[model samples]
Structures are given as structure tokens and as C-alpha cells.
Target chain A: MARGSTRPTSRDVAQAAGVSQAAVSLVLGDKWRGRVSQATAERVREAARDLGYRPNLAARNLRLGRTRTVLLVVPALTTEFFAGVYTGAARIAAEHGFGVVLYPSPEGIGPARDPFASAQSALDGVIASSMAADALTAIRGEALPLVMLDSDPDGSLGAATVNLDIADGIRQAAEHLLSLGHRRFLHLAADVPSWTFEVRARELAARLDEVPGTTVRTARSPISIEGAVTAAQAALAAPGDRPTAVICDDDQLAAGTYKAARRLGLRIPDDLSVTGVDDLALATAMDPELTTVHLNAELFGERGMRALLAVLEGRAPESGDIPVRLVLRGSTARAG
Target chain B: MARGSTRPTSRDVAQAAGVSQAAVSLVLGDKWRGRVSQATAERVREAARDLGYRPNLAARNLRLGRTRTVLLVVPALTTEFFAGVYTGAARIAAEHGFGVVLYPSPEGIGPARDPFASAQSALDGVIASSMAADALTAIRGEALPLVMLDSDPDGSLGAATVNLDIADGIRQAAEHLLSLGHRRFLHLAADVPSWTFEVRARELAARLDEVPGTTVRTARSPISIEGAVTAAQAALAAPGDRPTAVICDDDQLAAGTYKAARRLGLRIPDDLSVTGVDDLALATAMDPELTTVHLNAELFGERGMRALLAVLEGRAPESGDIPVRLVLRGSTARAG
Candidate 1:
């Protein structure tokens, strides 16, 4: 019998079953079907179970030279959007007999050093969110095959890039609001400095520029409902015509805009129209469901994983932006 | 120069630098300070850099026999509360020279299998949320040191347990509503059959039973805003003696209750008062901010990691549950 907390080795199990260590390894690895007799395999299995012997993953990983694990480094995991991305990534990874380890970009978690060391997993490659650009330097320092999500393709460090057509999503949002006679617009932007958010800002500004009589005001808030409420409240507090339409960077910010409008007693549609990006769960939970862009978060994750897989296999990643659509909901109406 | 996508081995670097494999290993591993000249170490580093060589983590992990990595098995990563928990755990883990890899229990992601296999990181220990109890069986099948979060102390399978004072949080929520002269109560409980949610349901019933006039109605919802909306709407639709005070299992549920009330044309703190647990950002995003129990999620995580560290060192895990508090907000009012 195994004694104390020390884990029993396969050698111990082999000795207990009166078999060679090679026989024990073969039986446990399931490669002994032809080589070892049925009776000997049964004895080995029973002995292994009784002793609670687990094959050392460390040894297996070393022998295989590939852990088949990939690290996904995202800026944060605080939202359902990223959750969907993770879900999609994990699904595809599993299909390819690969595993994904998540590293939520160590913002407040700790020092931003080797994410691989932090993941504690030997990784085949990395699929990182460009929002976690700060960690990119550290990631680029290593020779791992990397795929950057929502990053500028031109500026990327030879790493494969996957992007949601965020600029197009913003264009659709601006056009929807503009067609609704929302001449004066408030762009409620996420304060995070990322290429994704930058694309939204740039596209919205350029799209609105083409429409005459459009005056776009901007308010920046850290991506939280309370932060949006405070920032939007202050932005809208100015006298005269408060922007009749608000375009939020994402749904969480849009939820905040809802609070801001409510606090000021501005009724939705009748007094203010709002639009947001990333049709998150919060978008629909509102009294008037949010009118927003539906970025396929799951597909985004899937494509990101596929790109990483392509990079790993020394194949040029299938490129071209993943399309996004503007979802029309109850939140927007003809500007009052 | 190394060719193709295959990673350059230490031998490649050694050959490139005109040195023995042992010399290359010593210099690259930073163990050649006294034995090898400074020029030799510089030559090795340059050769490694030129070849884009990265030391194989698999071999290093085997040699060390400790990955210094821990897995945090969470039910889901969509909630800000778990994000906080992760933040806290990672902070403590980094301080102890350990890394945390998250495995959001395979709900939609994949089949329930070895979390270590899913995490793809060889782990030193595991800190799992009891809410993800379904994954615990697979976890227990391995010999990894485990510290369960929010699991029942009495029913624990000889593993260290870390828990929040959920019962006390429920007691506080109920007492606050009762003190507001609320006789009829609604316990908006999480439909999940976890020890944490069970404690909320059990403690609320017992506490409400202590008051003569208090009649607590129960409603269960899958932990999402939409699920809560549908469940709360149906529960409130029933004719006579509708609950004036709705005490939700968590803030997200409370958000849904707010939507149901809005749909039913019932104003918060006027026709009804509401309370939620977890004090998520959604709490304040509502017009009338939620009055909910504040479970220090980060502290809970920190404690869980501390307990796991203790177990790994063969020390007794710290006993006692982490305390919780109820934050008073506008959503709750004196009975009309």
C-alpha cells in the first residue's frame, strides 16, 4: 500500500503487480493491447487504481516535446463578450485536440512578466487580444507563434492578425443614428487605449464628417456602468441641446448611458436615442433593449484560434476581417 | 541560421557558437559565471538570439519537478465577482512565485474531463469554486492538492475548504427588508444546485421564519439577467399578495427583477423594494441602485489561495468563513 501523501509512481505499481516498468507504462498508456496479455493488463490496472498512480504529465510533456497547450492572453475577463470569445476558442482548440490556457493580461493581478511563466503551461503558441498590447512586448520577446486579435495588421510584429470589422460596425452605428435625424451625437467611448476602440472612434468620426449639420461630442469613461454614468452625466450636463443620440463603444457603456439618461429624466426615444457596440447581455436587459452592433464574439474566438493553428502549422493564416452587423433594437428611434 | 518553423534546440545554438552542449547549457542557464569566461556567455546568448531559440519549458519543468503553477477552476468567468476573485488570487499567487491558470468549468466549452488536461498546465495545486462542484469528481480522481471555495465544510472530501459567510449575507438582506416593515418577501434564488446558492436559500427561509408576519416566496432563476427577468416576471404575475421586498441571490438576478418590475409598471422602493447579493457593477447601473450584500470577492480569492498554499505545505488551512456586509442603497425602502 502507498504510504503518506507522496504520490505512488508507476514503478511502485509495476513492483506491486510483479511486472516490468516498461509493461506498466505500456498498459497505463493504453499501448499494451497487443503487447501485454489481458490478464497482465487487468493486474496492472487494479494495482494502479489501488495505488492511485497518475502518469506524470511533466514527464509526458517532456517526452512529447509539445504540451499541445496554447495561451490566450486577453486584456480582461470581466465581461460576457470575452466569455463568448473564450468559449469559441476553447471549442475549436478542443476539436483540434489542443487545450487553451487563459491569461487575463495581469492588469492588477501582478507584475507583467513572462505570461508563459505565469500560465505555468508549456505552450505551443499564443493568441493574444491586442487590447492587451502592453503584454505584447513581453510576448514578442519569446519566439512563440503568436496571433494578435483586433490589432493593426500593418504594425503587427510578423504575427498573424484576426480582427472584427470594428470600423464597419461603427460606420453602421453612425449611419443608423444619422438616418434617424440624430444630427447631434454623443460618442460615449471606452477609455481603454486599444486599437479596437480606436477603430470605433476613427470610423465614427469619419462617417459623421460626411453628413452635413452633424456635431459629434465625445465623453470618455473607463469601461464600467458607473464610470459611464458619471462621464455621461457630466458630458450631458451642458445647457442647450444635449446630444439627442449617444453612440457607446460597447454595451456596458451603453447600459451606463441608460442610467445617465434616467438620472436626467430624459426618456428613451422621446428625448434621447442611444446605440452601443457589442450586443452583450446587458444590451437586452435594459427596459428598452439596446440598438447595437452584434460582433460575433464566438466566431471571433474561433477565427483567432484558427489563425493561431495556421501559424503553428507554418501555413499563411486565412485573412480578411470577420464581418460584424448592426442590430436594430428598441433603444433607438427618430430623434425628437 | 535555423531554417523552417521548427524551434532551434540548444544543440543548434551550441553548434552555431562552436561550443560543447554542456557549455551552451551552462552559459544559457546562467550557471557559467565562474566556470566560463564572460565572452563565452555573451557568444552563447548572441547565438541563441540569432537562432531565435527559446529554452524548452517542458524539459525545465521536468527537471524542477514543480511548475509553480496553480489552476483556478471557476464556474464561469462572465461575472465581475469571479473576475475580482481571480484578481485577488493572482495577486497572492504572484507574491508566492506561483502562476494561476483559469479553467471555466466546461459548460459549453467541452466535455467534463481532467481540468489539468483542459488547463494544459502541469499544476502544483487547484483552487476550485464549489459552484463548479460537477468538475470536482474529475479533480479528486487526481492527486493534486486542492482547496475548495464556498464548499460545505461538513461534506468536504477531506480537502481544505474556503467559504464566504453566505448565510450571514442572506440573514443581513432579510433582516434589512424585515426592518423596513416588509412582511411579504420574495427570495430570488439562483437555480443552480451549489452549496453557495443552497446556503442562500436555506438561510433566507430560516431567517424569515423567525419573524411572525414575514412570508417569504421563492423564485429560482438560472444566473443570468434574462433568466431572472423571465422567472421574476412569471412569479410576480401570480395574483394576490405580491412580494413588496425581493431579495435576489445575486446582483444580476436583482437586475432582472428590476426589468420585471419595470414591465409590470411597479416602481422601485415605492411599490416594491429589492435586494441583491455580490454588489456587482450592475447594482448601481440601475436607476435606484441595488441594496445588496457585499461579498469581498477579492478577499475570498486571496483566502482560497492562502488555504491552498497551506495545504501544499502540509500546514492546516485557516479556519472560519470570510465575513460579508450589506451595503444600503436606494432600491430598498420602508414598506409603503
Candidate 2:
């Protein structure tokens, strides 16, 4: 072995090991299970180690015309939900020798400008949250394989989709409240225009419509604590009989409702009841704890990555929506 | 403009624009500001657009030996603080015609594996949080220019460092509590092994040591509401003169203190007063709100990116710690 300013190459390892360059490539790439003897592979690996030869991945990717890198396009990074998704996706990507680069769109689920340019990596595929559906136009222009998360399967323009059973979760929440003798309801909806939120609204309304005397008032706010506080305060202050039950789009909204209820001198499960989706850490941190839907963000991400991998491999993606469940906590009780 | 199976090249764009290939390159690369006339640049751009010609960034970066991209190595993405940092850093990077890629260390501020391989981009530099200090060893092996965030300036091995004035923030919190006549105190500290957390513990102890009769006890927990609840419960339940005031390392710990107080039939600011650092949304979301130190996370990120850019340009980075302030809410009062 010799050291110099110049880096050693694989050819030098082949020469040192007395093996053909192809044999050296196979051994180093870890694709020589049956093609080369174990002893020969060990010799090649030892020679490469002694010579300090590390393969130039960038150059190899360029030559192979496949970067083996995928981009995960999320709406924003301000929430831990998407962070969980990225963790699960990256875990799967690493297992298959692929890298997942995150691109949190600055436009907040709006039309993302050229993610390829922003990521600065030649990508083999993309896994995008449907909240950022508009970004798909630019992604489609590149003709890269794509998998959409929480998107309407019929409307993804043939892209593979992975979604949680959000409708079922909403149904469970409604049934729980209805069984607790709640009649009047306030639906605190996220103002974002996404298919997932649409499903929540549609499912909640349809479920409530089954009961003849049930009435639900709707209020919209941006998906933020401050925004939810302002919106919930106004709706709770409305005239006539106040809603006995409040169904929030997410845990943040439920947290805000707690504040609003406090301001109105309403007690949880005594004078008012609240429920939320996405049983985040905030749920348990709240005083009464929140009875809400639990969406497995990590599982959603894992499925999304798997679907993309299947698409890239020319195999059919796994079908069926991921399951979600209603977690009963202290926030919900019989209507007062 | 000709439509064909093969994509148009820069030579083809030059022919269509009736200019030399070098002139075409200048216009397309946005480097023709002084070399080419405004009218000629527009004409070349229009011709390229009409022919649907796009420059291949991967090949161009390989040739130039620069990616115009940088990696932001964060300890974790579970908190909104780092999200704010990424947003601010990315805003600055985009203005300078560069891209920022995020690599959240899976090991939670421990040794980060090869970020470049995971990012899958041949980067120009890195901006990292000192919380992820162990990852620096691998980064140093690549010899990429780096800027450390909230790291000890004397121990960064000559790398540029950007930091928040955390010690001063701690001083402010102490003074505010001391002036309120608090003598017995409990410090709910984060259990992370990082320099930032060490500063928090040291500063609190040193400041309390100033008063002749002041006494402070310390308890550590992972930075989560649930973890804080367990640790705070044990500390508050200890047999002794219960501390009238509690200083939390961050808002999440303060939230847990609130729960522990409730569990022990104690009311905030009546039986116990609580203060926290990092006035996150959880601060106001907690009942009675929370008085805390407000660290400017976005400004910290912007400064980190600017320092990295300075290093890349061979310029001296601007020196000074970013300022922080105390936000007074309703969580603290005169010691009972």
C-alpha cells in the first residue's frame, strides 16, 4: 500500500489483489454472492481497505443514470406529524440502499416551484403529501415516479396513493359523541383546501345527518393554535343554545377549544365536550386529556415509500387504506 | 423550434438564437449581466424556452466542482424550533441562489452517519447544530466548510460558530424570579447531553449562588411533556419544604410542571410559580399562560447560514451572539 496526494481507485485495488476489474467491482458493490469465491472476495476487500479506496458515489450514479435518491415533499416542517413521516420513510429508504431527501415546501402546500432544483439531487422518485398537490404539476413535468400520500385515489392522475382511513376515524368520533347523548355540535375545520380535510368534513356531516334532530355549526380556521383560538372563541360565543360538543380538525384546534371553554366558564364533560384528530403530544398535555383519532404518521410514511419503491421496480403497489383508531380519553363525556 | 424525440441542447439553442454557444451559455447561466446586452439575453432566453431546452444541473455541477447546495444538520425534527431555523436559513440561501437541504440526525443529537450520502447531494458546505456535535467527526472527515450553531466557540476546532445569548437569557429569568422574592427553587432541566443544556444548568446554579440564602434543587428529564410530568412529579413530591418557584429548561417542561402541580393539589403562582425558556406555542396554550425566555430560533438559523456563506467565500464571519428576551405571561408571581 502507498499514500499520496492522489486518491487510490478501484483499478489499483484490482491490480494489488491480482483480480480482474469486473471481479473487483462485483466484490466491492456487494453483488458477488455466487459469482465470486468467498476467499477471492475477502482478498479484494482487504486490498481495497489497505489501499484506502472509497468509491465515488456521485460519479457512479452519473454513470448508472440512476441516483437511487428519492425526495419527500412535505407541506411544512412546523409540525411533528410530518417529521414522523420523514423518519419512517428514511428508515425504509436506507434499508434498500436509497436516500430520502426532504423538501419542505416554503409555499405551505401551495404550488411548489421546481423541487428538483431545490433538492439539488438527481432523484429516482418522489413521495409527496397531497396537501401539496399543486407541486405535482412541476414534478410531473420531470416524468419521475411519484407516490401521493393522503390523496384521493380517483383524482391523482394515475399516481400511486397511500391514505389513512380518515373517514372511519371521523365516523368513530361522531358515534362516540352521539352515544354520549350529544345533539348540537360545532365542527372546527382546518381552512386548508386538501382532500384529507374534505373527507373529515364530509364524513362528520354524513354521520351526523343520520340522526334526525342533530345540528352542527361549522367554523374554519388556519391550522394553528392562535388561529384556532380566535375562531373557536367566536363560534362558542354565538347566540342561542351553545353546542354541547366540539369536534376539532386536529389536536391544536382542540387545545384552543380548551381555552375558549375556559373563557366561557364551560367545564369539560360537564358543560361542554371536545374531540380532535391526530392524537399528538398536545392531547395528553391538556388538563382533561383529549379523546381523539390517532393517525399512525410513521406507518403512513412507510407505506408511501413502499408504494414508490414498488412503482420504481415495475410492481403493483399494495392496496387498502392504512387503519386509524379513536383513542378515548377524558375530553369527551355525556352531554350536559 | 423543432419537436423531436431527443431533447434540445445548448448548441441547438445557440443555433435557434443565432448566437455563439458561449454567448448562449452566458445567458442561460445568468452570468451575462455585464457581458451580453439586455436585448440579446432576452432573445436567447426566449429561443431556449420555445425549443423547450433546460440545462442539466447535475452535469453542470459535476463540471464546475460545486453544487451550490448546503446541508443543515439538525439534532431532531420533533420540535418546531428547528423548523423555524430551517425556514430562516432556507430563505437566506434561496436569496443567494443556493439551496438548503435538511438532515435530521436519527440518533437524537448523537453521532450522525454520513449526511452527504443520506442527502444524496454533492454539497458545498454544512450548517450544524452543536447538539449534533458528534456528527461533526464524520463531517470533518469530508473536510466540508462548516458553521456550528450554539456550540462552544473555544472548542469548535476553529470552525465558525453562531450562538444565541442563552446565558444572558438564563440571567434574566433568574433576576425576574429573584426579584419576585423566590428563595426556594427547583430547576426542571432537559436530560440531553449537549452544551446548550449544560449552559442552562450552569447558569441557573451560578445565578442562584449569588443570593446568600437562595437554595436550588435540580431534576432532569427528556424534553417531552410526558417525561417532564414523571420527573417533576417525583421532584415536587420529595419530602422537604416544597419549592415555591420552578424554573424549567423549556416550555414543555413547564407544561409538565403545571400537570404535576395539579396532581399535588397546588395552583400555579399561588402555591407554586413556574418559568420556562423558549416561549413556544405551548407556553400560551397552557392554562394561566407561561412567563419564559424567547429565543429567536429563526434569527439563529439565518446567522448560521450567513456564517457558512462567509466561510465559503473566504470572508470573516460577523462576530456576536444573537440577543434573546424574556416574555412575561401569567405563569409567575411573588413567591407564596
Candidate 3:
């Protein structure tokens, strides 16, 4: 019960139980079913319990040369979507008797930094979100089995990749607004320099270009509500005609547009229609529930971890983009 | 680079540099300045670079008996507030040459479980949120230096406790509503069984008892906005005179109240006014910005990690409740 002291060692437990250290290890490791007698095992267990002996993971990790732990490198944990990814990854890891360590990459777009210095846990592999691509080079240098999430498949440098079919989701959102007799559009995009945000811009442009007489104006901001509000208000306040519909890259951006609209004395759906991707809880929390695309965040995390496991086992990774769906809600309506 | 293969070892680097393995270790471990020749150190560095060698953290941890890593256990990672906590903890950990490993305790209130198995990182200590109290006993068994965040100080069982002044926050919120001439109150509380929520309920009750002719009703729900909407709507659907002011434990619950009011054809600040704690981005994102108490989540995290470091150093933790503030916004107005 002394503070700042290390946990009791197996040797201490062995001494307490009147057994050898090997017998204590064998019993504690659950490998003594046949090697050691049940009575001796029970004695070791009792002594371990009485002494509060906990195995030294550092020693075990050194002996095994593999920790059965994977580091999940993410751009930011504040994003609700990434939280879902962690949930899915952790659940699958637990099922496999493995552990997950989260590394929230330093903010902004830069070369991906190695997580080893910060995680401290020796990792067998890494499953990183594309938003944290800047750190990928450092990760690749470690020669760990790596899986990239939401990255470009063709451009990925031999790492296994998992992606949400985001292009299709953007198309659905653009087409939904286009079908509502809208031509003028505003795309409130996340400013992060990643393939995911790039896809949103490219796909939305291509889809809108196919419809003649359609004009799409764009504004960018960091993915925060305040950032969205400032960028959106400026874009909406620009000198010319205002777009009747706003297509946000994510739900947080959509929420910002709602606040901007209120500031301008405009009503959702009545004056301007809005659409967003990532149907986070904030989507429904909006006064008029958001019309947005639902990307399965947990599924994304699960797939990323699964692909990493496959790579570690020398098996081919499962390839295919996870499908996303569009949910119609109160935020979108016929364009005026 | 071969997939699923171990990283280059010191022996490999030594062979590449035409030096002994001991020389490589001496240079890489930063002991070469005094022992190894400058030429040999340069050779070892170049060889390590060519072979892409990373020091085996597991072996080093085993030898040193200190990993410089700490586990941060929270009830949930998806909450924006907790994300801020992680950021703050990481910042302080970095400054102290330490690492933080996050373990989001499994959902639902069960006996606080040990995170050692899932984190897989050899930790020097732990800083846990009170919301994850179920896992504390298991953590206590490890005899790691422990620091508790937003937990009951008197009940911490010798573990260091750091807390936000939530009682003062609740009091400010209640007194603000009272000053606005509102008597009937609806406490939309998080259903999670944690000392933090208990403090909100207890403090609110104690403060309201000081005022005459005040009626307070309570409703509980999971912290999600949808859950809040459902629970708030159900509670509001009851036939008796409804509470004119709703005080939520967090911003998400306040957002849900916005939706619930819309469902019942009640206008915010007109038919019903609302206030919340945890001034999350969701607070400003609401159509009528929420009136809520701002808890500096990053400060909370920084303080928690600092306490753990103190414990690790056998020093007494800095003791004081972190101050909170109330921001009056559009959600609450003079009661009509």
C-alpha cells in the first residue's frame, strides 16, 4: 500500500507461496494446467492475491518481442466521427485479445510524426486515419504493418488502405440539392489538406458541373463551429447574389451554417437549404434536424483494424470502399 | 521493406557500421559522448539511419523499470470535453518528457476495470476521470500512482483528486435563472452514475432549497443529443404545468432541449429558457446560442496529469477546485 512503489513481483509471490519463481510464472501465465499441480497453482494464486502481485508487462513484452498492441494515429480526437472509429477499433482489438493505443497527431498538415516517442507502448502495427497522413512517413520508417484509412488507394505507398465511399456520398448530397430546383450552391468545406476533404470538393464540383447553369462557390475553414461560422458568414455576405443551398463537408460545418443563417435572419429550408456529411449526434440536435450523409465511423475503424490484422498475418487485405447513405431530414427543402 | 518483419536491431546496425553491437547501443542510447569515439558515433548513426533502426522500447522499459508512460482512463472518448482533457494531458506529459496512453473505459457503469490489459503500455502511473470510477479498484490493485479528475475528494481512498468547481457552476446557473424571475426548474441530468453528476444534482438541490416557492423536477438520459431529445420530450409531455427553465448537466443535453421545445411548439427563451454546463462548441452551434457554464477542459486535463506526476515524484498534489464561469447567451432571457 506504499505510494510510488512498484507492483509486487512474481518472485515475491513465489517466496510468499513457498514455491519457485518458475512455478509462479507457469501458474500465473495460465500455462500450468498440465505442467503444475492444481493444489500448487491455487497456493500461488492465493499468495499473488494476498501480495497484490501484478505481472510486469515491460518484461513480458521484451520476452515476447511483440506486444500485440496497435497504435491508432488520428488527426484529432475532438471530432465525434473519429471517436466512433476508436470505439470500433477497440472493440475488435478486445475480441482478438489485443490492445489499442491512441495517438492524436499534432494539429495541422505536416509530415506524419512517429508515435513511438509519445505512445511508449511497443506496437506490433499501426492503423492510421488519412487525416494524420503527415505522420505516415515516420510510421513507415518503423517497418510496422500499416493500414491507412480514407486515403487514396492508387497513391498510397504500398500500405493497405480502407476508405468510406465518400465520393458517392458527396454526389448524393449535391444531387439531392440539385433535384430540389437549386442551381446556386455554396460548399462549406473543411480546410484540412487531406484526400477526404479534397474528394468532397472534386466530387461536388464534377456532379454540379454536369448540370448546366449551376454555379458553386466555396469557402474553407478549420473543422470547428466558430471557424465555420466566420467562414460561412463571410461567404454568405459577399457582394453578389447569395447561394440558395449550402453543402457542408461535415455536420459541424453544417451546424456553423445554421448559426450563420440565424445571424443573417435567414431560415433553414425556407430561405436556404443545407446538407452535410457525417450524421453525428449534432445532426439531430439542430433545430431542424440536418439533412446529411451517414458514414459508418465504427465500421470504418473496424475495417481499418481488420486490414492491419490481415497484413500482420501475411494475408491479403479485404479491399472495397465502405458504402455511405444519405438521410433526408428537416434541413433540406424545395429551393425558393 | 518486408511486411510483418521485426524492425532492424542494434546488431544489424553494428554489422552495417563495421562496429560491435555494444558500440551501436552506446551511441544510440546517448552514452557515446563520454564513452564512444566521435568517429564511431557518426558511423553508428549513419548505419542506424541506413538500416532504419528504432530502439526496442520494450527491452529498454524492462531494463529501466520505468516506461515514462501514463494511462488516462475516461468513461467515454467521444465526448468533446474529454477530448480536450486528452489534449491538455498530452501537452503536460510532453513537457515532462512523459507519454499519455488513453483507455476509454468500456461503455455502461460496471465495476471499474483494470486498463493495464487493454493499454498494453507499461505505465508509471494513471490519471483517471471520476466518471470511470468503476475501474478504479482494479487500478488501485496495480499500486500505480493514481490521480482522479472530477471525483469526490473525501471518497478517493488516498488517491489524489482534482475537480472542477461544479457546485459553484450549478449555483451560478441557478442564481442566474432566479434573478431572471424563473421558479420552475427542470434538471436534465446525464444518466451516468458518476460523482460529477451527483455533485450537480446535490448542489442544485441545496441552492434551490435556499429560495422559497421554487419547484424542481429531474429527468435523466444518456448523454447523447438524441437520448436527451427523447427523454426531455417525454418529461415535457407530462400534463402538469411545465418548468419554464431547464438546466442541463452538459451542452449536448441543452441542444436536445432545443429540439424538444420545437417538438412541443415552445419557443426558446419565450415559452422556456434553458442553461447548461460544459460550454462545448455545441452551445454556440445551437440556433439560439446556449447559456451555459464553461469548464476549461484542457486545464482540467493539465491539472490531472500534473497531480499524477506529483504522485510519481512523491510530492503532494496541488489542491483546489478549478473555477468555472457562466456565459449568458440567447438561450436564456428574462422570464416572460
Candidate 4:
């Protein structure tokens, strides 16, 4: 399979199907709605599949004058959260004959200063995730097909938006925690000012406001375990009805909360309840496994890639917000 | 920068530098030695740099009839270690005006599957990391320039080999534990049969064997926190003075050891001492923080890329293993 010879091309598919090369192109191009009959189109698709006829990206790029490579602009690739998103997106991009190139917008160097000059070469579109809208001004130029993932759908700056059902996920978390008879709550929210986090803040507030006597306090951490520990420790030490339930922005934050509780002589799900988002590998690694929202990072990436592919083909994205679910584990329980 | 005009070429650089186009090409092409005088070459380079010139990758590929892109064959991209290698290699390649395209071997997907079928491009070379040499027979047919990262340099396949100073790193770790009066050690080794982990096992055993009264225990885990916890717990529970120190192959494994110690009523740097490698963010997140070896991921990437570039340009790479150092945090102390 790894021999140096070039792969069988679309022309090979045309010959195998005994159809005109143009017919093969039109059917495989997904542009034969009225030009070719449905039955004939299906024949071309079957033949292409049987012959294992992959498209020649170089030739198609030359003909169309646009490389089908989408630049996925992410904040960082070091974490499992973002890496999962990248994995999902790359898989989907691969399925549809498009290449996904990553641009981790210049950590310590900032995106505007050193965007991948090579990434700009022959890019068909871009999908930016968890980035400041203004930070994307460079990519937003020339009305490139842009899809924002997990960013503000309402306030996206000239880009199509695809997002997890984050507000609903928060609602689910609130319901799960509250159903356990917890009232006093501490939201271990991320200190970031991004819109996705804002959704968590607003949704948690709104959901808690429904119950009279429910109190919500907040602590901000820089989305790391140590940061979450320091912030959560101070938040839990405050003089008030101690929050029985703690909901964190991500699994790493949850791990920090675990440390904070240990220092304060509080035990998870017994003395203090905790929940986390982004069910990263860190969740189960905790002494008492963290209860967290399972944000399908790979699915998120896949959906983002699908949306970009939609934009590239001049078609609308297929559906609504991608689904997310809560995975209840060892970290939450009834009010004391 | 997105001006929709043909980017300034080498001809433009020659005019700007007030030199013949051939002189500019010779200097900018990194072939200035003996072909052009030092002063003239410096002037040409400065002019090209000031203009933010990039040699057109497409045109060069056409002229050479080979893509300047090198295919990186790895087992998977979902792994942090491999991702780190990719980051390291890509950074170095960018500096030398080469591109890296990843070709993750689809394990369990059978030999009928070839990565190049989907990637659909020819390459100037290949740099393989963490792949079985025997399984790479199909890939060996290309006769392309090749560099191996973290592969065995002895039964090797590539033209050049680059690796982290793993053996030395393990020695430093063992010596640190020994100096701290830790005679009984538990090696929380990764179950993967890769050469890198083998180096860790071999080096640690060798170092400890040299120290009188040293005792070593071994456990194999699947490189996940849960797997590490199970393996470490079983190992720690076994007899022989109940080893007070644990040396893990990676940061994630160290984290698991932390939980296992806590479960076994041991505290960090107190009843049990722990150490790890690859200083992941998890190291700093734990309550006591973790002491680990700082394998410079970016530098590793930069070196691999530089090596690939050198091979591409017919130059010699910087020799020897990239060194690693111990980042002592709060995870380990004297065996009490």
C-alpha cells in the first residue's frame, strides 16, 4: 500500500464505471443534482467506492485554484481538551477530501505577530475555536469561509458558528447537583472572558435563581489545577453557608478543587459536592473520580470540520448544536 | 499581507539588494559557501529577510519534481508524546522552509490501508517516530531521505536518528533518589514495548545495580492514570520493605502513583517519594506538585525539524541526544 507509485485516480473510476470522466467528476463533486439522474449518480458513487478511487487533491486544487485545506485556529494544543477537538476535526476533514492544518495562535508570541505563513498558503477556509473575536482579525480578512466552534454564536464576528449545547449542559449539571438536594453552590468558573464561559456563568445563575434561598458564589482560576486549587481554597474558606456543591469549568479545575477540599478537611461528595466539564482523562485519575460533563471534543472537531466543508461546498451546515451529556461520577452528592 | 498579488520573488530580492538574481538565489538558497563571497551573501540574505521573502513551495516542488514536504509516520496523533514530537519537528521544518505532513499508521486497520492514499502527495523525505521497523517494509520502498525520531539507532532504518537523552535522564532520576537515601524503588514502567521505555528500564536497572543495598521493583501499566494506579497499587502492596519511592516513565503515570500512595495512606515526600518524566502540566497541578524530568518538547521538535532540514539540504545534523533535566517540584523528598 505504501509503494511509491501514484494512487488510482478519478479517471480510473470513470473507466471502471464505463461512464464519462465528466460524469464521474460531477457525481463525485456532489454537483449532479439535476445534471445526472439519481440512479446513474448512485452508479458512479458505487463504482468510485469499489475502485477505491480517491480524488487527486493536487489536480483538483489546480483546476479549482483553491486547496481544500482548512486552517483550524486553536488557542493551544498541549491540553487534552483542545487536542480532542483537533482529533475530531481532523477525522471529519479527512473523510471529505479536505486537509486540516492547525494554527495554535502564537502562545507567548501572539497570533498577529507570527501566524503560520505557510498555513496561509492555499487555504480554502478557517475554523477558529475558543479564541477572542478580535484575535481572529487576521483570519477574517477577505471573507474567508469561517466557522467558530464553542464561541459566541450570537456575537461571532462575520463567521458561521457551530457550538456544543453548553448552556443546556450547564442546565443539566445544575439539575443533577440540585436534584441531590444541594442549595448553596460555588461555581468554580474559569477566569477567562470568552463567550463560551460566559454561557456557563449566565446559565448557572439563571438556573439557580429559580429556587428561592439558593446562593451562588464564584471563584476564578486560570483553567489549571494549581490555579483552581488556590482560587477554590479561598472561595470555600469564605464565611457563609459553605457551598455543598462545586461546579468547575473543566476537569483540570475539578482536580484542583479536589486538592482544595483535601486541605480544608472536606471530602468529595460527602463534605463538598463537585462537578466538572470536559470529561478529560483527569476525571477518573482523581482520588474520588470527578463528575463531569462529557463534551465530545472529537465530535466537536468533527462538527467544525463538517461545517467548514459545508461552507467550502457552498451548502448550509446540516443541523443544530452538537449534543453534550453529563457523566455523573464520584464527586457530587446530597446536601449535608 | 493578503493583498491578492503575486508575492515578491527572488528576482525582486536581487533588484532590491542590487545584485544579480543568480547571486541572490545562491545566497538565499543556503548554497553561498564558496559560490558567493561572505559580504555579498550577507547583504543578499539581509535584503531577503527584510522583505519577508518565502520561496514558493509549490514552484520548488514542481521544479524538483518532489514535494518539499516530509511524511512523518507515527502510531497515532492522539498521544501527547507523539504530538510533542510533531510540534518539535514541525517548528524546525518551518525555520528551514520545509513542511511536515503526518502519516499516522492506522493500527488494526490492516495492510490494505495506506496513509499516502488519503494524503495523496509525494514527498522529498520521511521522518518516522515510534513505529515498528518490521511493519515499515511497505514504507521503505520509497527510497526517500529519512530521519528517525525516538526509534532504535542500532537495528535502525533511517538515514539519521534523533532522540531525547532518556538513558541519562533516567540515571539523573535514579541518582537523585539514591542520594536521598531511597534504597527501595518501584519502577512504574509503561507496558508499551517501544525503545524509549526500554531505555528507561535498562538505564534505571543499571544505575540502581551500581548502588549497594539498592532494591528495585517493577510494574507495567498501559500509560493511563487508571492503568498506572492499578499496576502501582499492586506493586506497592507486594513485599520487600514496601518501597518508599516510585519512578514513573511519564507524568500521567506519576499522577496515578500519587493517588495510589494516598489510598495506601502514604503522603507525598513523606511516607512515599515519587518522580516522573516529560514534565506535563499535571506535574504542577497536583497538591504537592510533581518532580519530573523536563524533556524540552519544543526543542525536541525544533531539533527533529532541523535534522530533517539538514538532510533535505544535504548538510549534517547536530549530533548526539538532546539532553533532559530534572525539574524538582514538590513530588519527591528524602525517604523518611
Q: Tell me how far the alpha carbon of residue B283 in candidate 2 is from the true structure, in angstroms, after superposition.
A: 1.0
Query: Which segments of candidate 2 are over 4 A away from where they belong?
Result: A1-27, A31-54, A107-112, B1-24, B31-44, B107-112
Candidate 3 docking: what grade?
medium
lDDT of 1 by residue, A1-336 (tens): 336556778898999999999999999888986899999999999999988787777788888888888989888877878888988999999999899888888767656767866877678899999888678888886767899999989888688999999999989888888888889989999898888999999998899898888898899999888789899998888776789999999988899889988889999878899888888877877878889999999999999999999988989999899999999989999987
Per-model tally of clashing residue pairs? 0, 0, 8, 3
Docking class of 4: incorrect
lDDT of 2 by residue, A70-123 (tens): 999998776689998998898888878788898887753123557877877778
How many angstroms is residue B91 displaced in model 3 relative to the true structure, after the best TM-score fit? Answer: 0.7
lDDT of 4 by residue, A113-159 (tens): 33435342456788887654444766654356788887876677646
Kindly report which residue stretches of model 3 are placed more than 4 angstroms away from their true locations once superposed. A1-6, A12-52, A108-113, B1-6, B11-51, B108-113, B237-239
For residues B1-336, write the lDDT of model 4, one tens digit per residue: 434565568888899888998898889778888888888888888888777576654455444566656777765544356666766676666656666666555533344344554344556677776544433665555456777777688866546888899899899889888889999999999887688999999999999998889888999998778788888888998866899899999988998998888788888889888999988767776768888998887677667777778887899988999999998888788888
lDDT tens digits by residue: candidate 1, B25-134: 99977799799999988998999999878777677777888788888999997788888889899999999989998888876776685686677667889999988867
Model 3, position B272: C-alpha lDDT score: 92
Where is model 4 more than 4 Å wrong at Cα?
Answer: A1-60, A64-68, A109-116, A132-135, A157-160, A234-242, A261-271, B1-127, B131-140, B212-215, B237-242, B261-271, B333-336
Against the reference, the lDDT scores of all candidates come to 0.87, 0.87, 0.88, 0.77
What is the C-alpha lDDT profile of model 3 across B157-219, one tens digit per residue? 998999999999999999999999999899999999889999999999999999999999999
